[model samples]
Target: MSFLLRFIAECLFTVYSVSFLLYHRRNFLMKQNHLIFFLISAVINWSFSATWGLAISSHYGAPALLLIVLLELKGLYQMNPMQLLFESGYFVAVLYWGRGIVLPVFALILNQSVHWVRHNRFYYPVAWILSLCMILVYNMLFRHVIAPKAKVETFYRSKEQIRFVAIFQVCLLGYLLFINLGRYYGVDLPWYKISHIISCIICFAAQGLLVNRGIRNSSLLEYELHTELLQQQLERNLRHYKAYQKYAESFRAFKHDYNHMMTSVKSLLSAGEYQKAINLLDTIHETRHKQVPVQHSYSNNNLLDSILQDTANRCEEQSTQFSANVYLPAGHNISDIDIVRMFTNLINNAAEACAKVTSDSERFIAITSRFISHNGWLQIKTANSFHGKVLIRNGIPESTKPNRDFHGLGLSIIDETATKLGGIMVIDVDQKEMVFKTTLLLPVNIQQWNKKDRLPVRGG
Candidate 1:
């Protein structure tokens, strides 16, 4: 009976731990077949604990189990190895603390409660109610209250924060193990057990408070950084808008003077002063070309057109040739902010790559978009010339900038935005031609596009 109870308990704990871990990592695992691997790992973990007993299994069998879980996570998520290790270690710490401390304390409480109640018939029902209440509280606090404040991605990415939590859990586990050892040695000190359990509870509460505070601080820092970036983008947009306004004003002035210039040219021609007429015609042509530069209309979406024009202007300033043929129509499901983010990152990366080419003629950036009417998919492609080798890790090109942690987030931001919009991004590099290209495909409403939405392609 004891063996059966132990085996059942181990199985339940394994399933619970795996479920908790999977729930915490749902964002990363949603698109993958992670359930089967986790289920298999849980079964193996239960088998190990049932066969070898909790004592040997936790100490000796844990490393093997950790290795298996890490391998499964790596194969599925393609996360950094160091991050994987930290995640796996954190899981082990949580599992160890739950099994070693919380479960034992609950069992002790229940055992003591049965003696006080005298009527054993009500025990199972009471236990069931208590279990349900605990689960409800746990979910309400962790899922609803805490999760929004401390997003899983943000929490996991901060190595130091996770490391601190893991260490605290380990310390609590050690303290509980020591208490358990005293009980094993025939120490009949129930008060001592209760006191230690109380201490552990307080410690756990303190740890939770610390973690919450840390997460809040991290969130505040991220918000501030994001706000700064938005301010910078707003300033750039204002500059672009002002430049466009000036260009429009100059074009209007040219239009107002057109009739007078034409009349003057006709008069000069009628008088038969052939050389003077030719000079006057040449002067008018120069004035028209200088004042009314060709205005580009790359897309039906005003915001997208502005972004393209801004990028074009930046590229021109850097002596990099820029070309674009975009046709994004209005009234699409994609938000304007998301479109801005995706296109801005894409063009900026292309321009940066173009800047690396030594030969002026070879430096070029090209962007185009096509709507596949049949599939309701919009494909955007950017191609540019680059001079050096591009190192790609886990499908993302590593940033060549000195401050890699801060500078390399553009691609990730674009990729994340694409993913949020039910899209996929692909990158290709041609070593022979020294060209790098990025392609993004996003789902859009077919009704949003029409023949009038088409725009002529232009190159500089």
Candidate 2:
């Protein structure tokens, strides 16, 4: 094919890649701006790629592809230099082992330099100078002036080269995923081939969307977390506000009683009946306990407190037994929303599950939470009593009956939260009891992992 035709084909594929990224809305995952930054990113990648085509061989497209991928990864995982280096190293290693895969690997390596320059701004000239030097060095090493280009192409295009490269690519990705497997769903295995293909597709889409959306993952995650924190702050403040309201109401009632008592006391003094006014004050003091329900000692934020209290109240109203023991640390690293959602979803689920029982004794729900270590690893287990067949024995809950869109997402949400916190959740059923347990690396464990690698560092 003519050089012009080949260039056009590359352009087509590049455009396709960018378009796919937009459609997938990878940037939308973090709620990013949709115009300026994304346009700048796209123009930069393609412009540099076009420049490479003009200055170097048209084959420089490989590096362009790699450059885009690195930029995309930066957007996806919020990787720093060291982390980028590690990921690039892993990616390139996969390429290197495949022999003919050197072109793509070299492309990826070139991308590391390009991406660094793109972000650092001041490093642009350095990237170009280094890139030029690399091109010259590669030209000399291959002795392209002496050896025919056909021979090099022949070596790379061999059947064994293709197969080995494919194998290496597969293995590289599979290993990265394997490392993260326990961080996701329970102990269930992932289908590597399917996952890799899907992930690649998603990555392709993510890159383009990132360009269009002007999204940087780290910035976006920070923003999201900030928003959630604000929401919690508002909710906490709202709780305090309500407590103040209750106090205000109690104060007003006391003021009215005082005026009425003063008048009554004078009348009583005239009648010489002093005991009645004293009895009135005593009566208000006696009813105070009933007016204000007992507050749990574990702080107002103890997630299960409200749920348990509500449950107990309902049980009293219906004459049923409801017992609960929730022991969880306060102001821990876990987010309030996650704990709130988990407690609300799980307990409500259990409550509804047990409500179907006809007999009052059998209708009870027992909940307990404790920190347990299996193999000396910290985990929290919550078990509830239920009747009838257990629907989900494995951590994964089965599909809710048709048209119930929200039911299945509860457990799925639980699984997702557990995974995000780098924890595992399991659901097991025995006789009439359904137990859901999730073990998160105590916040300390996360700190330890962060210590293993410094923040904002990417590996090349």
Candidate 3:
């Protein structure tokens, strides 16, 4: 009965530890039908422990650990063997360290000496209870405090990390198996205990190194994000200043033309040529309107307005025909920087494409945005004409222009923005029509739409 109880307790502890580590690594096994997975895990754990006990002379947990590593390859975790092994080994190491500290307290509570604790019938059961409590506390601390501030991907994303960890774990496992086999053979060497302690310290040091590296990576990632945001803000402000200047110029031109128009109108009226006066007024109105530059309003969202205005100004300078029909609903919840990044990249790519066209009459860019899917999604589309071939790989366009190092980031930037905003971007090219189009869709919560202020500007 004692042996049976110990076996059951060991199996339970191993499953709990593996599952906890997997959850922290974002495997989230318990997300779907917890009871079913738990049952399956229990069966596997029992079989694993039984197989080790029946054949392997109780080699502390080497065979059992190896079995778990093999099983995880086919498990629902979606991790490679080395990654799974590292996670499992780390969990085991942490639990062993915790047990080394807490099991003595248990021994004292049970009125037994520390040496007697290991040989006692209740040793495994007590260890199981203590390990479970420790695992729970560590899981909470890892998820809430440590993980939020660290880059977990920095450790797992590199193949070098996997190879290093795998090699270290294999060495540790080999040493452990050797020591346990020596004990099974009644070869109680003094160095066995010393080697075990040294190995524990090494494992602790390795884990500490991993944690430090992850923190450093997280800091670097945050710094890069901050720098990118500052650049975007600077660009947005510059565009706003330019748009204001253009508006002022257009207002001044209209004001100057107003007096001349009044004088012409009065003279025509005095001649009593009613039809001619009407015709002259119409002609004057058309001429004044043409003389003043048209400032187009694209959206009620001010951020979108600024970006569109900037793009329109660029098109005008290039003598390209530009048309925009954009309506961003009131109370749009997206951040200004993300809006700037996404639209800026899209429009910049379009402008560059249209500028290369030799025929000025054929060069054109069009932009449109609307709330689609019953306001649950925002769809933005841009179309422009191009003269050269567009190279696309993995749905990403490669830069065809000179200075490839400096020019290929436009679409990548847009792709990153779309991913951040829970959106997708599609790029399409019509070879015969020489038209390149991009469509972006983002999930959004929009309250209302206001399209009355939209100005459709067409450049001659």
Candidate 4:
């Protein structure tokens, strides 16, 4: 009962891992890269496990079996069903004095690779002969079964040893399947080459299925990493946007009050309250001075804030006055994952560029974003100060710094996100002011936004 439970546990673990792999990289099964990965795992599992089962009954006996079950559950790649069963059967046969059987899967691989794998003169024959000799020696010397493990080996042996070992393996496969035929399809054929061939074909299919699965697993891992990056970027972008929005609103209020104050001053001048108006104007200047120390924060999302703060802090440590504004859309139109990719890469790029300068004041950046006319379209702009010439082309900075082989790619990321959203990207540079600006249209499909570039640019 314990054994049955263990077996189920291992099988389920392996299935779970494969399932997770399939989910993460749902498209990987369609690619050929996974095929190579599975083959590599198969080769490793087959050679080691089979050798263990032969030498020590305990290798697959109790504790090791439990571990294997756990490992299978954990989804670590290992031996397939056919390899495990056939190898255990072979060990039993070798221990109890029966005809030498071998792993026919290895035989097929050898037959295919013997001529091509560098004409290994001491190869195929030597391998099987050595395998048989080791078992026979264990039987003769110790008078019991002993499994053999080679540091490196594959079943595709060369033309050096006796050819009969290959035949023995093929026959063994046939015999094993013939005995178990009742468990599968109801074909009542006797155990022979034909039966073995059918099983081998099934083995091939299994291998293919596994390879596709592995590829999918790899792909899933890759995408999961991407989703994480995207999530971080989005938070950063949103934070930068919200800060700008607050600043815009506050400044608008301040300006409205100033206009009223200006009207009062004009009336005071007409009524000959000139000294009062002068005193009022002086108070206004002081008030505006207090407000003029304008502060704009970058990001508010902690997940995103960490990235921006770390980079901005690094820039400040290098003496750059780095400031950014983030604004999240009113509703959850964009997935959080995609947003992460945009801001993480963008903010990192901005900090790196600012950090390159030597002069303290030369290093500076300002990031701002807003929705166009309360519409769904988001407009992002990042401006940074630099000392040297700004050679920007088509919204990408062509670096003037020598010795580096690569040019701009960060903007490329923003451009890519924008493109995916069906929007355009723009960049501007003022060499005289030592400023670089990047503008991107956030992909928000607002009902108020016209697709025909006919929206008004409001100051608010």
Candidate 5:
């Protein structure tokens, strides 16, 4: 009966662990059905747990079982193998060490000997409760706090990060395996207990240090990404400025020749050549309309005007139906560079999505920005048409193009800019309509926004 109870408890723990893993990487696209997931998880977990109990010592069974479970979950979640390994290894370490810390401390407080507790009739229930508590607490902390900011893919995406994580896991596994070896050899009680406590502390401190280092590395990468964005923005603005300068020069030359052309038209009219004068007038009007400087401003702010105008020109070049209804007042607390980053990314993404539409008539992007001064809110809404499957991970769309080196940064920039402005962005897609829409809401009034709250314009 005791053996059966232990087996059941172990099996349940396996289910709990794998379920937590699936939930941890929930943002990854999952194609498996819920029933199938449960069935496969249970069958594999039960088979492994049973096999370990029958053929392997409990000291080596748990980690071996969990490692296999992690690999199995990789297929179900479509997660990068190294990421799954790193995450699963860390999770198991936490589980094992957590119980190591909790159980001993708990036993000491109750004045219960470890041997007596293990052999006691209430052992299964007490152990199960403790295990459940630790797993629950770990899951909550990881899901609510760590998972949100983890950037899980980054662990495997960067070679350096992967190498570090691999080394960390190896060290962790060695420590756990060493403890098991000590148990297998029947090491002296007090010494093993002391070593266990020390190992737990070392494990926790090592994890904390590595996590801090990873965060610092992530920040450095973000700075690099931001720098790249700013350089790209500058190049775009420079090209637009050059185009406007040429247009200005052409307009001045047209003005210089305007009087001469008008005099010729007047002379032709005076000579009773009505048709010839009419033709000349038509040509002059067409030239003025077609050859004049492009209007890039839809709002009162010059920075926004430049961005929208540039976006409009690109859309026109691609035969996309682009429309803008921006109404930012002259003097608000919004950062100019932040605004540039925001709209530049938004419009560029929309234009790119629209560009994929094979039918010219179907390619359209509409951008609207409105400010409610009384409410101290700014709203930007952009909608575009896209074809093909859209891949979104952690709420940001992934690049569909073959050359992804430079493509996927736009939406991330928009997200970062919105966050810096103390605003929220909402994205929604209508699959049937093939439309993607995103809304960014910000508090723009000086009363609601502090100048000091503005993020640094320097990319670094």
Candidate 6:
């Protein structure tokens, strides 16, 4: 009967662990065949618990089981190995702490509260139900409060953060080991229950401190990144404005010379010097072509066109070919800033990838957009040259930089913006052609523009 109860408890814990993982890592697990992974994890956990008993399994079997679970998750999810290890370690520590500290603490409280009543057959069942309720409440708190504040994905980005979390989990596991050792040696004292409650309080406080720190750090980092992006956008806008100013001045000069050049051609024609008239017309055309600033419009929307033009200039400087054929109509319901943010990242990433290609002829970036009036969806596609391996997870590419903490937010930002605007972003990598392609579908409703009337502005 004791073994059966222990087995039931182990199974319940498995359910709780799987629930926690699914809730926290839904973005990672949802794309993959995670049901089988969960089932296998539960089997491994239960088998160890049943064979060695809960106490022995937690102490002697957990480390090995952690290694197995880490490998399984890595193979299934293709997540950062370090991140996965930290996640697995924390879960194991929590399991040990709950078994050693939380359950016993609850049992102590329940025993004291029900001491006035006579012992009955329903007592154990009532206690088990209460314990389950406590677990449920904990899960709710974790999902709503703790997980949101301290996202494991954000927390595990820094090596220092990983080390900090590892230290906390190690301390937690060590404390549980000590408590288990006392139990194994029959070292229970009159004050043991009080110590258990106090230890639980200390553990909760420490975990809360860690979570609070993570929240603050993540928020600050996000704020800094946002400010930096805004600064870059401002600079790009300024450069675009200057380019327009130059073009306007050049156009004004050409207008001033137009009448004088036409008068000279008229004089030569009247004098019967047909050759002189042709030569004068040729000179005028050559001067206009040389003096005028060539402005290429790539989209109907002014801001988007400016961004594309600026990207084109940068691509030229970098010796990477850039082409854009976009027709974004005004008042598309999506905000201008969001449009800028999405396209800027998309173009910048493509340009960066193209710059990495060894062959100049192979370095190119192409972007095209189409609006499906019937579906009220705008489709945008970007293709660029890339020369290396790309690892994609959860529909986003992984950062290949040495310091991944700061380098991988571009695609994520674009994906997030697309999602918020009722759109989707898809990425495709063609190893055979050495091309990286991104397709985005954004919903837009424009009463003024249709498929037949829309004129795409194409430039390179």
The candidate that wins on TM-score is 6
TM-score of 2: 0.37
- Model 4: how far is 420 from its true place, Å? 0.8
Candidate 4 lDDT at 362 equals: 75
- Candidate 2, residues 328-358, lDDT tens digits: the string is 4332356767775565556556666666656
* lDDT for each residue of candidate 3 in 1-460, tens digit (9 for 90 to 100): 6677666666656666456535643422223454465467656655654554222224556556556644543354445455667666655555554454454455546665444556666674556556556656765665555544235544443334544665676565555446445544544344544454465556555655665565555445534644664586578668787767876887788778777877877887898777887887788678767766566666666767777776776788899998887766554556877776677777778888888899999999988776764657878888999987887744667788674423555675677678768888899999889999999888865445444434343222
Segments of candidate 2 deviating more than 4 angstroms: 1-244, 251-285, 290-320, 323-331, 371-379, 432-460
lDDT winner between 3 and 4, please give it: 3
Per residue, candidate 1 scores C-alpha lDDT tens digits across 1-460 of 4444454455555655555456546445332666676666667666765554333213344566557667766755656555566556544544443333343354466655312322233442343234333433444465556555336455544445555655555565555555555544555355654665576466546656655765665455445544655664676679768988888999889978987888888898899887887898888889988997777776667677777777778888888888888877543577877876777777778888888889999998888888887878888899999999998865778888885544566677688778889998998989888999999998887765665665655544
Question: Mind giving the per-residue lDDT tens digits that candidate 6 earns over 1-460?
Answer: 6446555666675676567556545445343666787677667766764554333224566677567667657645645555576567766655544444444554465654222211223444344434545556665775567756336445544445655766676577667567656644554543665676577557655776775586567556655666776777788889999999988898889989988989988988999989999988889888888888788988887788878888989998888888998877543666877876788888878887887899988899998988877767889999999979888865678777775555576787788788778888899999889899999998887665554556655798
Task: Pull out the clashing pairs in model 6.
Answer: none
* Residue 295 C-alpha lDDT in model 1: 74
**Judged by lDDT, which candidate is best?**
6
In terms of lDDT, model 2 sits at 0.44
Error of 4 at 141 (Å): 65
lDDT-wise, the better of 2 and 3 is 3
Clashing pairs in model 1, backbone N/Cα/C closer than 3 A: none
Models sorted by TM-score, best on top = 6, 1, 5, 3, 2, 4
What is the overall TM-score of model 5 with all chains considered together? 0.61
lDDT computed for candidate 1: 0.64
Angstrom error at residue 383, model 6: 1.8
- CA lDDT of each prediction against the hidden true structure: 0.64, 0.44, 0.63, 0.47, 0.66, 0.69
Looking at model 5, which ten-residue stretch has the lowest summed lDDT? 451-460
TM-score of model 1 (CA atoms): 0.77
